[model samples]
Target: MNALAIENLSHSFGTRQVLQNVSFTVAEGRMCILLGRNGAGKTTLFSLITGLYYARTGLVRVFDMAMQANPSAALAQMGVVFQLPTLDLDLTAGENLRYHAALHGLPTKLSKARSREELSRLEVLDRIDDRTCALSGGQRRRVEIARALMHGPRLLLLDEPTTGLDVPGRRALEQHVRDLCRERGIAVLWATHFLEEVAADDDVVVLDRGRVCWAGPADRIAPELGVGSVAEAFALLTGSP
Candidate 1:
């Protein structure tokens, strides 16, 4: 089964519709980039998927379990990193991860081991005892990513995870996520407006005005849009000029 599936998802805040029939699927062990500008409804779509808000229409399935009907099962299979930082500034990195693991019912020993593994993978294991507020933006982001993986989720959802990072930091985080897919076989749905974050081999879903304007391999986008580059194709497809 696909790692995640959204069928005809539509949502509205009062009378203002935010998402209109947005639908897509992320295959297991692959990365699918959700590309859209601000106000393109990416966060709204994510909120629905993560059950922060219920969809007024349509369905969301994680690992073949309906999100609304089987929320626990569905959510247990996914990890999420929101755009804004959610870490406790005063807490140590290890403490933060242990807290998340506990919330997921992980045993103390297992949580510690997992936390060590993930933090080491992200190259933040040395900062495990440091207060989160003392870490740099990139280090904190890495800690967040490690915390998200504490529960061993099969699907990962990252919303603009590289926001506010320098060029090298952004590249490092992006490569780390791609490596997670390659090495750990985790399905990832990464939402971002930056074209450079997308690899040529990546699957892509472009949202324009709260709707999917295109969804396919990144390499195919330019040709399909009759443009010479993905950036130009994106501008053309989204009518951004």
Candidate 2:
């Protein structure tokens, strides 16, 4: 079954339209890449899906649960890591995660256990007692991801997740999330502007100026568009020159 489905989603701020009739689906255990250049409305689309704000027009469903009509239930199954770093610097890694667990109504004992498990899986358990500010950039990112999974969410949404990481950090973070998706049967919507992150078999939706300009398996883009690579095809499809 589809883990996420967006139908005819459009959003606007007064006279400026941010997203125009965008639609897509992400199946369970699949990684769907929301590939768009900056300013293409990637974050805006994420906000809508996460119910930060209702879209001017559209329907968003998570595992067949409609966001508008059953918002709480729908959101409960989703884990999101936005473009910005959201962890409190003053809090220890474990504390931040436990706080999130508390918000989700998880018991204190279970929250601690999950926090430890998640951090361990991400190879950052040693930093659990350390303040978030004391962790390195890569380590902090991993903690944020661990925090997102504390509730065992079935769908994960990451918007520009690797923004400030080095090349190695970026690649490592990408692999970690991919592994999580496969192992947990989690559907993931990873939004990014980096062309190198797009793997050949990845399901990609190319957004341009608030619209979906192209979408399909990454490898198919080149072959079908008569281009040599995903980047070339992306440029052609989005008029990127």
Candidate 3:
């Protein structure tokens, strides 16, 4: 079964309709990159998937569990890193992870061991005991990612995760996420506007004006759009006339 699935999903805020007939799936152990411009309903989709907001219509399934009917179950089977950081700036990185562990009902011993391993894997072990507010943007982002994995979710949802990082920082975080897909076989649904973040082998889904315009392999999009780069391909597909 697919790790994440959505069918004809639609949502709106009063008069403003956001997502319309959105449909997609993320196969187990694969990465799906969600591409869209600003105000394209990326967050809206995330909200629906995570149960922060209910969709006006359609289905959102995570791990074969329906998000609307059983949001807690669906969420427990997944992890999330929102576009905005949710870290407790006043706490140390280790403390932050501990808090997350408790929130997820994880066993203390197991959570601690996993926290140490995750921080090391993300290359932030040296700062585990340091206050989160003392870290740089990239460092904080990494911690948030590590915390997301505390429950060992089968699927990871990241919304504009590389937004504020520099070139190298962005590259590092991207590689880390890809590594998660490769090593742990965790499926990732990465939402972003930057084409550079899309890997040549990754699956691509383009959202334009609250609708999905294209959904296929990244390489396939380049040829279809008559473009050499993903950015240009996106423009060709969703650009203004």
Most TM-score-accurate candidate:
1
- Residue-level lDDT of model 3, residues 1-241, one tens digit each, is 7999999999888889888999999999999999999998899999999998976699999988998888889999899999999999999998999899999998899888988998999999999999999999999999999999999999999999999999999999999999999999999999999888899889999999899999988889988877787888898888833
Worst 10 residues of 1 by lDDT: 232-241
Clashing pairs in 3: none
**Worst lDDT window (10 residues) for model 2?**
213-222
lDDT of 1 by residue, 1-241 (tens): 6999999999999989999998999999989999999999999999999999987799999999999999999989999999999999989999999999998999999999999999999999999999999999999999999999999999999999999999999999999999999999999999999999989989999998889999999999999888899899889988896
- Which residue ranges in model 2 land beyond 4 Å of their true spot? none
lDDT of 2 by residue, 97-174 (tens): 999999988999999999999999999999999999999988988999999999999999999999999999999999
Candidates 1 and 2 compared by TM-score, better number? 1
The global Cα lDDT (0 to 1) of model 1 is 0.94
Which pairs clash inside model 1? none
How do all models score by TM-score? 0.99, 0.98, 0.97
**Model 1 TM:** 0.99
Error at 138, model 2, angstroms: 1.4
